[model samples]
Target: MTTPQDAIAARRKLTNRLIAGKDARRLAPFLASDVKVIAGDGSLILGAADVLAAFAGQFADPDFVAYVRTTTGVELDAEGARAAERGTWVGTWRTAGPQSGAYLAVWRKVTGQWLIESELFVTLG
Candidate 1:
């Protein structure tokens, strides 16, 4: 039996893999319709479409390398309908050194699956 935490962890891993592969289209399913994101650079991205656009734009850059997230923790609410995920993320580029930071993601259970509702990422180093 897969617990919700385990399921969320697996989803996070899959999301990381999709980002690393630059598969923006496939990543859509993981985001909520009204998802929001505050990028590590302090840019605000709203909506699933806009988020996908941001990712597509990033992937189009020739110097773009990869972004990978390592989840440190996942906490669920009492109802088990929502969860908060904390992790460290590292982004690499062909022309620049790697940048690493911490991130927080809020997820909701929708249609029996976990979808990212919002994410706030802060660049530390």
Candidate 2:
């Protein structure tokens, strides 16, 4: 059985994954099939594949620099099957300048794995 602590840890790993600015492959295990993402640009993206494609493009750019996420708070349900993670994300692109934002991710336990079901992020100037 997945404990609440394990769920929290999983969420941490997901943040670390983003911070590393690694390949989108690292996201597969943490994202649900129908996951919804509201990016800082205010664009709406749906599904794991679309999300992956978006990142692939982002990561492909050489100017796409560091990506980091810092979780300030996380709340898990009694059953530990659902959670909300709120944090800030800061990124740098070679020429686009810095993009920083606050994010809230709603996670769901799917197939015994805590996967991000929906995420919304807003850019901060």
Candidate 3:
């Protein structure tokens, strides 16, 4: 039997894996079949496959680098089996230059596994 604290910690670890996974390949599993991603620019992306396809070229670029700097203000709702995590990420692409952003990710435990349900982010200096 896992304690609530233990479960929360495990989830946090998984979240980190999702953020810094190998070339974003690890994200393929958690994404729902019909996952919808809304970009910071207000563009609606439909389906996980579509999103992956869109990013395929970018991920292949050797000069495209990304990193998540810090994660904080994590709130877990054990009762609801949902969690909200906040973090900052810095990305540098040789062509596009550099960008830093803060993000809020909402995750839910579905079928005993945590999956990111939605994410919203804003670019920062």
For all candidates, what are the clash counts?
Answer: 0, 0, 0
lDDT of 1 at 65: 85
User: Which residue pairs in candidate 3 collide?
Assistant: none
Task: Please provide, for model 3 over 1-125, each residue's C-alpha lDDT reduced to its tens digit, 9 standing for 90 to 100.
Answer: 97544564566566455554535666566655666666556677677777666455556777765545356666888586887767776766667867877877666777887666766667775
TM-score of 1: 0.97
Runs of candidate 2 with Cα error greater than 4 angstroms are 1-6, 18-21
- Per-residue CA lDDT of model 2 for 1-125, tens digit only, reads 76655566666666576646658877777788999999998999999999988888888888887677677778888887898888888888878878898999888987776788999989996
Pick by TM-score: 2 or 3, better one: 2
lDDT of 1 by residue, 12-125 (tens): 999888988997999999999999999998999999999999999999998888888888999999999999999999999999999999999999999899999999999999
- Give each model's whole-structure lDDT: 0.94, 0.81, 0.64
Better of 1 and 2 by lDDT: 1
Top-down lDDT ranking = 1, 2, 3
How many clashes in candidate 2?
0
Pairs clashing within candidate 1 = none
lDDT of 3 at 9: 53
